[model samples]
Target: MDLRQLRYFVAVAETRHFGRAAERLHMAQSPLSQAIRQLESQVGATLFERTTRRVDLTPAGTSLLEDARRILAGVEDARRRVEQVAAGTEGVVTVGATDLAAYRLLPRLA
Candidate 1:
């Protein structure tokens, strides 16, 4: 439903074990499991088929996995772009120079 929950879902989906997913996320297992449950409830579908040994994605989970990954990647890209702008490292730079000056100077700058 949210980024955090989606992240949690991806972790569990990738690892196929709640404990391992929790370890990968550096959180306690209980909260990770709760988050996955909450995510499933919010989505109105059972996302994972869980057994004592491992977890497997249901059809709905498989469908969401791809979208969740794309959404997270987009969020990260936006965050990076925002940081670049904040740091004055983003956008275009235009320089004006005479033809000869550009021929002489641009190579050295490059």
Candidate 2:
């Protein structure tokens, strides 16, 4: 559904352990469980098959994992592109100056 839910789902799916995912996400386990439940309800499918000893992905979960990864990657790419545009760069930059000027300005630029 929403990006947050997809993110949480991806975290859980990757780790295959709710507790560890919660720790990695820096949140409590209970809320993470709830969010996953809500996500399942929204999608009308069970994403994981949980046992006392292990967690496994259902067929739907596997499919969602691929899609979620693509969506997240696209989101990150978009953000970086926006940053580059706002920075007044379009994939390239060139600076020309005398050797002495370049050496002198490098430190200040840094």
Candidate 3:
């Protein structure tokens, strides 16, 4: 439902084991499992088929996996763009100069 839940879902989905996903996420397994439960509730679908030793995505989860990946990727891209702009490493700049200044100074500056 939210970004945190999506992240948690992605982690669990990718690893296919709650314990391993928790380790990969650097969190305790309990909370990770809880978050996934919450995500399943919010989404109104069962996302995984769990056995004693392994986890597998259900059809709904398979559908969600693609969108979750895309959404996370877009969020990451947006975050990077915002950070870059804030750090003055990206975005547009406008300069005003006379023709002679543009011809000479801009060339030298570039």
Candidate 4:
């Protein structure tokens, strides 16, 4: 549903335990569980099968995991692009040369 929810879902799905995921996420277990519930509700599917002893991804969760990964990767790439542009390094480079320098020195610089 949200980035935080997707992060929590991915962590839980990978770890297969709410407590472990919560620990890895540095959050309390209850909120992590709540976020997964919210995510499943928003997606209109159960994302995991839970029992006393184990947790497993539902088929929908397995499929959605790849989508979530792509979504996150895109978001991060966009952020990085913005940061690079802000830092004046978004594939823009400056080269200085003089007419005489080009004849004798530019080839060596290259």
Best by TM-score: 3
Shift in Å, residue 80, candidate 1: 0.6
TM-score of each model, in listed order: 0.82, 0.80, 0.87, 0.81
Candidate 3, residue 65: the lDDT equals 95
What is candidate 4's local distance difference test score?
0.92
- Distance from true location, Cα of 75 in model 1, Å: 0.3
Q: Pick the candidate with the highest lDDT.
A: 3
Off by over 4 Å in 4: 91-110
Ranking by lDDT: 3, 1, 4, 2
**RMSD, every candidate, angstroms:** 3.5, 7.0, 1.9, 3.1
Worst 10 residues of 3 by lDDT: 3-12
Clash counts for all predictions: 0, 0, 0, 0
Q: Per-residue error at 38 for model 2, in Å?
A: 0.4
Q: Could you give candidate 3's per-residue lDDT for residues 10-110 as a string of tens digits?
A: 99999999999999999999999999999999999999999998899999999999999999999999999999999999999998999999999999998
Q: Supply the global lDDT for candidate 1.
A: 0.94
lDDT per prediction? 0.94, 0.92, 0.95, 0.92
What ranges in model 2 sit over 4 Å off? 91-110
Of candidates 4 and 2, the better by TM-score: 4
lDDT of 2: 0.92
